[model samples]
Target: MNRHRFSTEEISIFRRSLLAWYDIHKRKLPWRDWHDIDTNIVAYRVLVSELMLQQTQVATVIRYYETWMKQWPNIKSLAEASEDDILKCWAGIIIDSIFYWSYFFHLGLGYYNRARNLYKCAQLIINEYNGEFPNELETMINRLPGVGRYTAGAVSSIAFNQANPILDGNVIRVLSRMRCIGSDLKKKSTTDFLWSLATDVVCPERPGDFNQSLMELGATVCTPQKPKCNECPVQNQCLAYQQQKEIESILDIEQCSANCSFCLKSSDVDTNRSLVEHYPRKKSKTKQREETSFILIIYRLTPKLEFLMIKQKQSNLLSGLWSFLEISSSKNHLDQMNEQKRKTYIIEEIQQMPTIDTIPSINNIKLAGQCRHLFSHIDKQYIIYYTHCEQNDVLIPSTSMQWFNEEQVQTSAISTAMKKVFNVALPQIKLKTSNGKKNGTIDNYFKKKNSKV
Candidate 1:
């Protein structure tokens, strides 16, 4: 890899000029402004926004950040809110793998816990330090959870008046371009060198401002592509400028603005004419799977409307997701009961079969819905049937089953498939007494509920 070394004097000149340029051209952002900032609130916002920004674009983070801030204005509020609500906010963003989404939720829970720590830190500030954020970077960083070096540096340099160096994408880009370093930026040694350089150049008195300025220059004038040499304050000192290399034409300024990197590639007509046009391709074929099963469970409920939901004992793919118990046919039962007989048996068992006959209190058994939930790896078609009794029904479904309402179901940590099942199945079982005229089915219940509300 090609590498360039900078003399101590050259580094000093660059740092000083960049800081000067930042003073004049720093971009205005909401988080950086201290006026009217509730330190704890801003800290929480910063933490959430930063977490969401990982492997995601700034534009995508903006609306989500605002939505979350609006919903849970404080750490306590966020912690108290349902994970489902939070996950719903992250709906389209989640990769849809039950495992990934589950892990992501827990990861966010860590952040929420960190927010609580920030709250505690804030309380300390109000009680002891008179509401001022600690000026020391180490002190502040030590108080937050999951706040590693980069985040700590970002917060300290941007939020508090601390001189901490940040090694982020913009800084990496600027460093790569300025020093003409060709070593992969992803390599640890290259990153460490950049961090050392960043630390060495950070101005203590205006550490935060100077650091932000470096980022600003990298983001704007000394951008990843088509750096505006005429507008750049330190163009005279730039090695790329002095070398008079083809670096300036490395990126097409217009194409770069439109997120068209391929378009930026210089194409000479003669060499490329024989190739096919790049874009359209036929869709790949998907395999069709055939699965048959009888999802069996007796839905017994208490008179007061608490429906049973069971958690699985075995850790299957949708291990943590909820569903009624399924009874798989042994080879003999399946062989003996032909397809039609099997279907009839399933309906009868779901509607009338009770492991326990009478609830200790008033409870009834009923049919819910028959539907299917499709997952990427498996398709779960459920023959969901429901039965109900009063709140104090005869039996609570052993340790596996707990009663939950529709609203509660929304917040439960269930699989996307289970969520789909709940959305479809919940409306089928109605609690109210009808004139026996299909009085209160799930659809009608929802319609009436919506209209009344």
Candidate 2:
């Protein structure tokens, strides 16, 4: 049995109130500013923005979105871009999201999924759909690489003006409050209930605006922290607000048919509880598993200054970008390795490298220091080290290992964590000053020496 039902009149009021609020208060975003509403053009822009936004904040994606639009401009252009180029742009140093990190000395983050999916989506649209976004949500959901139900509904309603339903975090929050649902959001049952409500209230005449309004209301007014109920245009329709006021028994609301299976019990709503902030309940935070990464910034001084880089196996690529050779283990394991053990481990790892034709005697390598990079789930420590070839050893490059001079490393599409490693290392790899003093930087050495590959 349906727990809640909105009448024709009630749905009408929701549309009018929500659209009026959205028209006046929607954030000034680039995707919303298109002057000409060509269906293909709108779909392309919407697809890129929506893909970039997955698991990311709007404030963080704006610049990347702008740059991406200018660079590609259309589906055909994006379809032609290489995987490396797509990954480079999509990750854009992976600035938008922090969700790709993990622990337990296992599995590369699925950070590459978004980049790979979006790339495949554009190509499919170009090759299969004749360079235009499909007009129907079913086609998109079924055929497009990364277009899931939420993305499909968004593209359908916004680009094609279809009355397809959508659900994202903001929508989930807003609807949960409006309906006063107090169930665990992580559960699938709660999500199905919300999706039903979304399908019900979305006005066919203005589905895009209506859906955007729900998200806008959730983001700006019905926020997770401290919702501004006093300013909410739909506060009259919101069950949570009414419950807070004790204005009327919730069961008596004119539109609802059955008692919600998920509503908070009356006794659970303490009189001491504050305003409308108690609508949608939040689950407790998961305890994050912690780990540390031991990184090596292996370098060579032959011919000129250069850093050795591993062609990183797919399992180890961070954010799906190549990294220098490194190891991951628990902090306890790292702590147990004494100075001599650490030195021995570094030497053996180098000796195993196929790139070095003749590594010098064991004394050339030295510990450079430490740096840290924070990910959403993992707390990582980069234990840095450096070594130099004997200035005359012939270095052989492999498909799995190669040496890059400072400039090449700087210009390469390195991951954000890798960039931090370079920053920690540059100052530590001391350079010789003109007076034969060892007080300069490798950053300067590259500029003067014109280092070879």
Candidate 3:
């Protein structure tokens, strides 16, 4: 790996400039309120903020963070809280944008696995560490279920004031541009090299502020697109800026290398301002795999209406979360089946289940149209089917399955995918009752329940 070496004076200038800029321009976030606070409380706050900020934007996390602190306040309180309550707290942060015509939200708060992991993490800390967060990075990573390298480093440096290096996405972008590293970020070798650069430049005296300054600079000034290079405090020490200046100094620009030595990519460099934005070239994203599932929104018209929901197994993708009964087409031997055969296959599979002995006639079942829910690497297509069964015909569910009334389903720890399924299927189910299609009863239920958030 080709490395950029800075002189002692250059490194000193870089650190001083960045720290000075950070002191003046840092965003006033809830997690950064470290003044007059205990070390344990600081550690807990940092842990929670880091976990919440994973793959979520800062603007989205701020209100959620504030609400969480008010509710839980500390690790002990969080540990004592129920998983359902924690999920409710998380729901406060989730942004649900409903399109006019579609029942599915554009983005759902689909972090069910992370929420479960957080519950287990809080329990682990309370039981193992006596309600105190671990200070050592190694212990934090080893003992905590979901604390990865970046999170561990952030907590150790920010909360404990330890001289640790963090390589989050923001820090990676900052370091890559500052040092003119043009390697593919998806490669492990490139990531290791960036971590080395992070370690090399981290200030020993104020490790917390110094590390955060780099990340802040990336988020505020050194952005992914159209970065404000002229306003950057450490522009003097930036290798990418220097390379851009060199290209701009050329008399015959066409004679210069189309692929410059810094980024090793073709570029005109006609505008020095835009050159810095091109250094951290990212690799193309991998295509998401397509998956199809048959979701059964089985309901009974008892004295009060009740829906059948199943708890996801520990071995499943959304472990410990409750969702509608889903039969993946892959497992049902319907990969090659036609549309009619697929529906038939789903009905046959549901009939075979021991817990559900009798269901309504096929003519009475209604298809509530298809809805999509996206995971990190899977594009899930759900064929929602609504069926009504008699109360006497519906057998008592085993330990894995439970019958939930409208109120229970509304307040349960169900995934956003299941929520979408419910939102689409419930209206059709209501049409069979006295309430007409335009009554908006299901919408009222979700609004009344989730409105507190």
Q: Write the per-residue lDDT of candidate 3 for residues 1-453, one digit (tens) a residue.
A: 233546677778988999999999999999998688888888888888888887467887888889889988888888888989988776555542112223134234345556667778788889998888889999988888888888888989998889899998789888877877665677787788788878878888999999999999999999988888899999988877766778745333223345434343443233343557755655654346678888978787666778988788899889898888788876346557876776677788877776455344443456787899998767898889877766667556776678899889889999888888888887777665434223457566556557768
State how far residue 105 of model 1 sits from its true place (Å).
16
Tens-digit lDDT track for model 2 on 1-453? Answer: 333456677778988999998999899998888877788988888887887777567886888889888988888888898888777876653644454343122124656687788788888988888887888888898988878999999888988899988999889888877777876787888889889889999989998888888888988998987788889999888877776678455333233334556765543443444535655665764334467766776666654677877666566536445577676657777789998788787777666765444545545556777888777555678887776655456556666667788888888867777888888877766443221234266565675567543
Residue pairs whose backbone atoms clash in candidate 3: none
Instruction: Please state the error at residue 124 of candidate 2 in Å.
Output: 0.7
lDDT of 1: 0.55
List lDDT for all candidates, in order. Answer: 0.55, 0.74, 0.76
After the best TM-score superposition of candidate 2, give how far the Cα of residue 314 lies from its true spot, in angstroms.
Answer: 62
Local error of candidate 2 at residue 284 (angstroms): 2.5
- TM-score-sorted candidate list, best first: 2, 3, 1
After TM-score superposition, the amount by which residue 192's alpha carbon in candidate 1 deviates from its true location, in angstroms, is 1.4
Backbone clashes in model 1: 22
lDDT-better candidate, 1 vs 2: 2
Highest lDDT model number: 3
lDDT of 3: 0.76
lDDT of 2: 0.74
